[model samples]
Target: MEKKKRFGVLLCADDSEYVKKKYGGYFQVFVGLLGEEGETWDLFRVVNGELPNDEDIDAYDGFVVTGSCSDAHGDDVWILDLVRLLRRLDSMRKKVLGICFGHQILSRALGGKTGRASKGWDIGVTCIHPSPSNKLLSSLCIPSHLLIIECHRDEVWEPPPHAEVLARSDRTGVEMFRYGEHMMGIQGHPEYTKDILVNLIDRLLRHKHIQTSQAEAAKASLKEKEPDREAWKRLCRSFLKGKSLS
Candidate 1:
């Protein structure tokens, strides 16, 4: 019998009440998107300082770094530790997938720069244009442009020297990037549903992270279009599972 593939999620955020009740947390959301038959997934709440020991890193097929409310460029102790861990994973050539803040942190860990966005928060479904050189996406059934859920104030200013920018948007230059064959990063949340994004927008507004007008604008954008969730699922699963794009 073939062995089941094992995956780990390095969760970088605390679960909101809605996420906990609806999906059991962001970890479950990702597993729902990426997990398949004969696959097992686990979580490490890295935001809470829980991490898999370095010696045990080889146990999983790949690791996913989840989004965070914290700044990727912040000098927090746990953030520093996570950066070091990412560096170690890169050295091992382990497959690593990063989302949002995860994307920024991966860039930082790999000798890139990340900082506040010049245009302020992007808090809605935005279209991303994939690069022509991203041959891995050729096998997927998608259009020239893909819409994805985005809610971020920080952006990747520069990608690592060895990384290739895979996608870009009008608001952010590096929407997606690939490092070598084993590492990839996405600035948008492919795992999120429209309802989830709506809830997040409300939360942001309540916390004063964004103004009421901005929240209304973001919600209005959602009515105009929807994210290409199915295509994103296929693309992300193909990358994580080592499946050929062709």
Candidate 2:
């Protein structure tokens, strides 16, 4: 029998009540999107100061850093710790995939710059054009433009040294980037569904993070176009599983 592949999720956000009730927390949400038969998935609530031990790092075939409510540029202790962990992971060439805040944090760990976007928050469906110059990305067989669900105000101002920009949008310059073959960072939430974005928009409005007008516009945009979920899933799975994309 073949050995089971193990993956770890470094969850950086607290699950909303809606998500907890509907999806059984973010772990299940990620597992639902990325889990496969004969594979074991583990969760670590990094927001609550939980992380994988150094000795146990080798146990996981890959690691995913989930999106967070906190700013990646914040000077919080946990954020600093996560940065150190990422640096260690980079040195070992461990496969690490980052989303939203995770993406910014990963860039920071790898000597990149990140900050709030000048154009403000980008919520709802966004179309990203893949970089034709990236030969590795071309092998993925994805379309020239991919529609993905995005909910972020922070963006990667600059990618790390030796990192290649995978995709970009009109609002965000670095929508997706890759560092070597072992690490990738995505500014959008490909794992999210329309419903999740709706709930998040509502929450953002309630918290005054965004105005009602912005929320309404974002929600409206969703009705106009559906995300390319299957393609995003294929790309993520191929990258994480180290499979031939072609």
TM-score of 1: 0.97
Query: Candidate 2 has which clashing residue pairs, if any?
Result: none
How many residue pairs clash (N, CA or C atoms closer than 3 angstroms) in each of the candidate models, in the order given? 0, 0
State the lDDT of candidate 1 residue by residue for 95-159, as single tens digits: 89999999999999999999999899999999999986566887675678999999999999999
* lDDT accuracy of residue 35 in candidate 2: 88
Which window of ten consecutive residues has the lowest lDDT sum in model 1? Answer: 237-246
How many residue pairs clash in model 2?
A: 0
Candidate 1 wrongly placed segments (more than 4 Å): 244-246
For every candidate in turn, the CA RMSD to the true structure comes to 1.3, 1.4
lDDT by candidate, in order shown: 0.92, 0.91
- State TM-scores per candidate: 0.97, 0.97
Residue range 53-165, candidate 2, lDDT tens digits = 99999888899999999999999999999999999999988889999999999999999999999899999999999887765567767889899999999999999998988
| lDDT of candidate model 1 versus the reference | 0.92
